[model samples]
Target: MCRWLAYMGEPLRASTIVLDAKHSIVAQSLDSPLGAETVNGDGFGFGWYPSDATPTTEPAVFHSIEPAWNNQNLREITRAVESPLFFTHVRAASGPPIQQTNCHPFRYENWMFMHNGAIASWPELRRDLTVAIDPSLYPQVLGTTDSEVLFHLALTLGLRDDPIKAIGQAIRTVETVGHAHNVQFPWQGTVAVSDGATMWAFRYSTSGRTRSLFHSTDVPTLREMYPTVERLATFSDNAKVVVSEPLNDLPGVFVEVPESTAVTLDGDGYRHQPFLAA
Candidate 1:
């Protein structure tokens, strides 16, 4: 398993959430309270839309095989760079080698994706699924982890045009292949994907009991509840975050994403809908 966080709002220094929260992503990497493993030291990665004039194109990425907590460059970069949309992931290496390429927050064009779960019995079904990927896109598979393969499969199935439907189809495809090989619980985890603006988070599993996932409540409402908490005023009204676990112990600050649901966040607000197999 792994731990990850995604942010979408006004541009702010990455450290404000990635390193400054009470239990920030960096802290969670070393001492995660909700993950299956406390120490996700296998590797870590960060992807963010640059602050340049043309920021909506492709995001800049920084990945390392080193533990996130111990990476000095990550510390320096977080304090230096800022973005309205960003992704950070700490890996625990479910079934892949610990290398830069295997580190997450994978990129394709303008979209960035990270997952905090595993595909059950991946080795058994890898051959069947890999063979199904479109030939032109097949060459992009650069890592051995099931996570990257899953991303490419979603792209092949139409992630760019209709992400929600494409992901549903991809999961259905995985379930169908896994069952034929007698593997129960074909999928498990929390997944987040974002273009430069809108973001989507999904919680699902073949067995129906997925890992923990949460999203922050509206910032304005939180300010009304805790008017004296100065930290609450730092974020803009549109600020929103989705993570594998609550970043702080502040009650009402985070809401658990329901089982088998997809959460979408954009300029309007948050929306939740049932995530069914396609």
Candidate 2:
């Protein structure tokens, strides 16, 4: 229902991905060709590790009820700040109240999570899903959106220790609850999560048709392919981006994540694994 992008690799200004690209995240906020909603203007949020010295382990978050395209603060911060990992999301509220808290890229400690999907029949499934969350995490459920609930559900299932399995279990729970309520096609869209270092992205749905997800190919290869494109030099070899859609139309620049798969991107590169009900 929305559009989002996650970056992991060498530290670079957030604008490089969020605002500077040919089809940047800011641009997508107004014109998302891949999202279920064409214009994701409900609100926007960003979460990133601070570059300055600090003892804090939590990532900094900025959320606003204003449309991202019109937010001058976002433009200023994106150009000034840099991070090894960051998440930017433009919201298209499915049914949640439009508030800063409802904006995405939700955080817990060093972890940042965002989703571009919805839980079908959410009103009917909300009570069951909330009850399913571990009581320890129940208090952290500050928002009413199914997306935020799903995040806490993943945490309840042990996202901090094993993100892959945690997310798998969370989805399985959603499917179970949806089935019990007779809600067909209970899941949709791509999700991205990060712990300020490693990133995990998933593309899956109950009906087998998930939303768009793409990852950039190696920067070095892209440079060789388009030698005259000087912007490629701005990124380090380790740089990688997982986005709802390609930021640019560069051929071979983005590879679509297959349906029912989890993609892990780290310093070693990207790896894909099967994602099924667990």
Candidate 3:
């Protein structure tokens, strides 16, 4: 259960959506038509925040247990990198062991995160979410993915003092430790996070069936509906994109993202709400 994308505003080029979009993100790591595993190839990764970053600069990452379409250094380092904000992931090792420190955006200092779904059983809730993290972030949790222990349980329940109320108390502490181990539908998912200048995305599930998320439909409403593509005249009417799907099957070019909501983008644009986390 993995697939990801998050890009925010202008400064582009990570091969314009992880290798030229059209089901891209290395073609959903070799074919993931709306994933839940149709060959996510076990591993891949990316993280960016550079376009002259300085909010405590720590974005450049690139994990790889390889096979994001048989890597050639993930296509020459994502076309030699450029960014306004970014994250790209394609992993399908749901029980965590594809190596490269369990890939995905997962960082901490200036924040970045990624996930597609699953906390459901996670080996019976990974020792109650790794002893509820935050003993100074449990020695920096070097990977045993329930998506990097739900991003250090949303940075020990306060993601820098309120990432949407600390991911709604880190997904209500993963459904209160998966219902005291009885495990009834303990979370499933879609999440994205960023802090080198605001970006957040989420979709939820305790069993309302969530997965698939999308965003992008506001370059003045797709330039008032297409008006001669030309890559929508090279974007930048405050360009934005969020995805677990839809890097173009263009019909209003991506919108979904509405099950328990929470999409936000900054520099004054895009804001969604009602994501009560678990």
Q: Please give the lDDT score for candidate 1.
A: 0.90
- The C-alpha RMSD of each candidate to the native structure, in angstroms, is 1.4, 1.6, 16.6
Q: After superposition, how far is residue 101 of candidate 2 from its true place, in Å?
A: 0.9
Query: Mind giving the per-residue lDDT tens digits that candidate 3 earns over 9-88?
Result: 87888887799877788888888877878888888888898899997888988988977999889778889887888889
lDDT of each: 0.90, 0.91, 0.85
Cα error, residue 254 of model 3, in Å, equals: 2.8
- Relative to the true structure, candidate 3 reaches a TM of 0.34
Q: Alpha-carbon error at 44 in model 1, in Å?
A: 0.6
By lDDT rank, best first, the candidates go 2, 1, 3
Residue 155, model 1: Cα distance from true site in angstroms: 0.4
Tens digit per residue, CA lDDT, model 1, 1-278: 99999988888899999999999999999999999999999999999997552535898899999999999999999999888889999999998899998999999888888899998999998998888788888888888888888888899999988888888888889989999999987988888887776789999998888889999999999999889999987899999999999999999999999999998899998999999733
Q: Which window of 10 residues has the lowest lDDT sum in candidate 2?
A: 49-58
Candidate 3, pairs of clashing residues: none
Candidate 3 worst ten-residue window by lDDT: 269-278
Cα lDDT tens digits, model 2, 40-63, are 999999999875524346899999
Off by over 4 Å in 2: 52-56
